[model samples]
Target chain A: DVKVTQSSRYLVKRTGEKVFLECVQDMDHENMFWYRQDPGLGLRLIYFSYDVKMKEKGDIPEGYSVSREKKERFSLILESASTNQTSMYLCASSSTGRNQPQHFGDGTRLSIL
Target chain B: AQRVTQPEKLLSVFKGAPVELKCNYSYSGSPELFWYVQYSRQRLQLLLRHISRESIKGFTADLNKGETSFHLKKPFAQEEDSAMYYCALSGQSDSWGKLQFGAGTQVVVTP
Candidate 1:
């Protein structure tokens, strides 16, 4: 089974503070994704990394960025945390295959004060 | 651009009753649809996919290309069936392993 682990389950930060959310996958998957899940909006992709040192912008990438220095780890960075940026952050990983399912972490509920 | 839509925000059903969760999508190319379930305190996981045509935990979804819908159906609901269900659409031609997710439907199965 694929295990996707998020570094934190809950987080609190003040506005304008720099925030980092870490994710690690043990399955050696080639794809990693970061998403912000909100009520009534479901899950919106923030950033995705297909390989080490490579990243792509997702649907909502204005305030967020991602880094994949290592293949098994992907980190999401909030340049300046804001109240609107607070949400449940989810990390997912999937192996390269046809119709492969992405394994998700438990998620991190972030609160920006 | 592709979009996934789940019309119902919440669905309530009694144990042993049938349940159906509707999902619709607007995509130009060939679409791959999937159902994901997030139980309380658990991570979101794939329940079933249209390509698999297989049932999981007594839940099944059929893709209707003509109607652009993939609705999940369960013949008998159980208390454990209560969860947040999300319908997703994958764009095979445009991207890899990226999915468009619906807002999700919260299902409550009471005894």
Candidate 2:
């Protein structure tokens, strides 16, 4: 079974605080992604990394950044948390091949107070 | 721009009754469509993909290119089938790593 692990399932942070959400996959997948899931907005991609030290911005990447220092790990960083950023964050990974299904980890629900 | 739309926010059905969840997409290329399900307290997982053309748990989805839709259907709904269903499309040119998802539809199966 493929396993994708998230560092935290639930988190609360104060406004203007810096936050980190970590994700790791054991499948040696070359593709990793960060998305924020909201009530009516659905899942919006924040950022993604196709290789270590390489990252690309997604549709809603204005408030988020990502780091892929290692092949198996990808991290999402919130430079300054805000109330509007409170939402469920999901981490996903897929192989290098095109049209491959993405495997998701248990989401991390973040709340910014 | 590639996009997916799930028309219904909620759908209810009785056990053994037929169920259908509508999904539509807008893309110029040959899109690969998929249905993903997330059960309560469970992670989101793939239920079926259009490319496979196979039924999963008696649920099937057919891609109608003419209509730009890929709707999920089940002949009989079961209690265990109740879950949040998301319609997704693969946009390889944009980013092979991520999947664009719909707002999702909540299915409730009554006994």
Top-lDDT candidate index: 1
lDDT (10s digit) by residue, model 2, range A1-113: 88999999999999999999999999999999998988877888899899999998988998788899999999999999999999999999999755678899999999999
lDDT of 2 by residue, B1-111 (tens): 998999899999999999999999999998878899999999999999988999999999999999999999999999999999999988657546467799999999999
Q: Enumerate clash totals for all models, in the order shown.
A: 0, 0
TM-score of chain B of each: 0.97, 0.95
For residue B21, what is the lDDT in candidate 2? 100
Local distance difference test, per candidate? Answer: 0.93, 0.91
Error of 1 at B69 (Å): 0.5
Model 2 chain B scores worst on lDDT over the 10 consecutive residues at B91-100
lDDT over C-alpha atoms for residue A84 of model 1 = 96
Scored on chain A only, each candidate's TM-score is: 0.98, 0.98
* Clash-forming residue pairs, model 2: none
For each candidate, the DockQ is 0.70, 0.65
Model 2: how far residue B34 lies from native, Å: 0.8
Tens-digit lDDT track of model 1 for B1-111? 999999999999999999999999999989888999999989999999999999899999999999999999999999999999999988966355888899999999999
